[model samples]
Target: MTPAEHPQPNAPADPASPAVELTPAAAELIRVLSAVHGPLMFHQSGGCCDGSAPMCYPRGEFRTGGSDVLLASLAVEGLDEPVPFWISASQYALWRHTRLIVDVVEGRGSGFSLEAPEGVRFLIRSRLVRQPAS
Candidate 1:
């Protein structure tokens, strides 16, 4: 991995990783989910409650177009490939300056998300990103 894309010890702080990432638990769970569901993608909506939660779907099952923004392709350890994370364009407009983290928690997941049957759900947590002074 490039030092800028995947930071190593003592690496420069500038040119950090993507705007979104996955927690270890979330990444492990993704390894399980992807094994059963094949390739996967994540989409977060601008709505409330579960609607606001990031929903993981089998790739191609959910149609994405210009209205959706591809935030990042998150890497999960032991997985053959990265998972694409997407957000509604309008939601991106509101959250563009924040770093989004996907975490897995014990709960009833949305029926639409593949993780629902596993008794765990994916949640989005955010931290404000400081813009570099020009």
Candidate 2:
């Protein structure tokens, strides 16, 4: 599909308990990111405990799989290039166990975030965050 015609992730077929939480700080940040960057990208990579998790970026272009779900899309000015990203298989396993899916939205202090279940918060720049894309 054309970039402008990008499709959003269809609401899941099954509803489950929320596995992630959002702090007031996180909520405000996502609002800004959404207003500025537009759409965010979610990705994960290898690491500890949770193994790795999701992140967001301003929407542009991405080289991805046909089955890859497009959760949402945004158009931000100035950032005209696609930012590359990846998430670890281990992290994906964690996400699968919970109803929570890593997502991209505006953020505070950091450019992105990892909102865990029950208001637990983590910044995008933490060691807990990974960039397999790098």
Candidate 3:
């Protein structure tokens, strides 16, 4: 069979199966941020204050260690690699069963998050993933 006709291994049959998704506004902002920051990444930690907010940084600026869990890889326009969305391992433990949706709103979040300077913020909205009936 030709390459196009060959079945791709381990590919999701449904394109929307990912645990995380981005809103149109968020995707556009990510594209803009990637242009300014070169490449970007996001991390959300379970902590007080700013740590609870989703933080975006230029890739490699924020180091992910063993304590971090990669929850999803998001496809953004103009970026070759899918942007990684991570959370602290502990945070992931609490959120593991939920689907995270990354979105943008008109407001300033933590000043440290890259989007803060743009008069907007990136936030995560989550919902429990429905289980298949037994």
TM values, all candidates? 0.84, 0.39, 0.81
What are the clashing pairs of model 3? Answer: none
Error of 1 at 126 (Å): 0.7
Off by over 4 Å in 2: 1-14, 19-21, 47-53, 60-62, 66-90, 99-134
Give the alpha carbon lDDT tens digit for every residue of 23-122 in model 2: 4554455555555656555544445433343454444433445433332232223344322343343443333333343333332322244333224433
* Candidates 1 and 2, the one with greater TM-score: 1
Better of 1 and 3 by TM-score: 1
Ranked candidates (lDDT, high to low): 1, 3, 2
Q: Which ten residues in a row have the lowest lDDT in candidate 2?
A: 125-134
Over 7-33, each residue of candidate 3 has an lDDT whose tens digit, in order, gives 343223343667678889899999999
- Best by the TM-score measure: 1
For each candidate, the alpha-carbon lDDT, in order, equals: 0.80, 0.38, 0.77
Q: List the residue pairs that clash in candidate 1.
A: none
Reference-based lDDT, residue 90, model 1: 85
Candidate 2 TM-score, true structure as reference = 0.39
Error of 1 at 132 (Å): 11
RMSD (Cα, Å) of candidate 1? 5.9
Q: In model 2, how large is the Cα lDDT of residue 104?
A: 32
